[model samples]
Target: MSAVGLTYLTLILIAYGVSSCSSKEKTQRSLKIAGLSLWRLLPLLAAVFGLVGLFQVFLPPELIEKTLGESSGVASLLLGGGMGAVAIGPPAAAFPLAGTLLSAGAWPPAIAAFIVSWVSVGVVTLPFEAGVFGMRYALVRNGIAFGAALLIGLLMGLVL
Candidate 1:
């Protein structure tokens, strides 16, 4: 396993040990709940992997590079955010897709914007957000998130 993966596993083990020591029954219940959650998430994970596989096969590297590569410049950052804002699915699935884009020669700035917007902008949830927190609040929050995503992308570009 990768170092990060190993580290996470070790931390989880330590936490579980502590929990079990404090209350075996509660720890067991927690484990059961975790297992059930994982079971429910399995389908979404499988579908996301399938989507990633399809993207790898169907999206040509040249096309990706031409559209979102270095030559695309600052414009690509906006494009990336726009794409991400409209993209469906959980943020967990977007990571692999972002990796694929990077591998395909997409600009780091664009990928960074894509990730940030995917996690924060939430175009798909706009209606629900508006319903729960008023239209003005939703729009303002999304607008701020989109702007922040671009700023983050610019920073990433400079750093990377």
Candidate 2:
């Protein structure tokens, strides 16, 4: 397992042990709460993944690489960020697509920009964000995320 997963497991074990030591009732309560919460969120998580799978159909991997690879200069990086902003899907789909683009001769900075923008500033989810957090806050957050992605991409491209 990943270090993060191991760490989380360890923490959970420790917590369970402590609760069990205190009293069996606490342990049972904790497990019940966890199970109930997971059950409650399962449907929402499934729906989100379903939406992500549907969204991935819009962007073809070959086209992404071709467009990003056509120019290695700053234009490509900017375009990568733009494309990422428009493209919306889950992290599981984005990473593989970014890897494919990288292997297909897309520039590192452009790939970085795409990955960062895809995670951060999501135009496709903007309406939901605006509704949840107010339009002004969502706009400002997305604007910052877009600029940060470009800067991060530029640095990664130049430095690495």
Candidate 3:
């Protein structure tokens, strides 16, 4: 298990122990808080997991390797960036996709860029983002994220 999973398990154990030893009111309060937290996080978790499955079904590793893995210098970089823009999903979703791409022989730098841009910059969620955060904020944030992803990819190519 991951460190995060282990930590969550440890916390649950501690919470159970404490609830058992506490007064009824305190135990009830703790349970309510925990329930509320889980309720709040459920939608976000579901969205990420759903996106992950959808990506797995739609864009296979072979396609990623074929397009972005080409060695055409600037054209390849643009292709990588474009691919990232097209694939809209969460970071959790992108990790598995990145693994698949790597296994299919995609360059590490391209995969890194694609994953980072996929999450950090979201063309698909633009309307929702603009509605909540304002168009200017959404546009600027995405623009910066896109540029940063490209720069990061180039640096990774150079360093690694």
Which candidate tops lDDT? 1
lDDT of 1 at 111: 95
Estimated TM-score for each candidate: 0.90, 0.60, 0.60
- Give the range where candidate 2 is weakest over 10 consecutive residues by summed lDDT: 50-59
Residue pairs with colliding backbones in model 3 are: none
Candidate 1: worst-modelled 10 consecutive residues by lDDT: 88-97
Model 3: how far residue 141 lies from native, Å: 2.0
Tens digits of per-residue lDDT for model 1, 1-160: 7999999999999999999999999999999998998888889889878978987999999999989998988778888998899986778888988998899899999999999999899998999999999999999999999999999999998897
lDDT of 3 by residue, 96-139 (tens): 66776666667777777787788778888888899999999989
Give the candidate number with the greatest TM-score.
Answer: 1
Better of 1 and 2 by lDDT: 1
Q: For candidate 1, give the lDDT.
A: 0.91
For candidate 1, the per-residue lDDT at 54 reads: 88
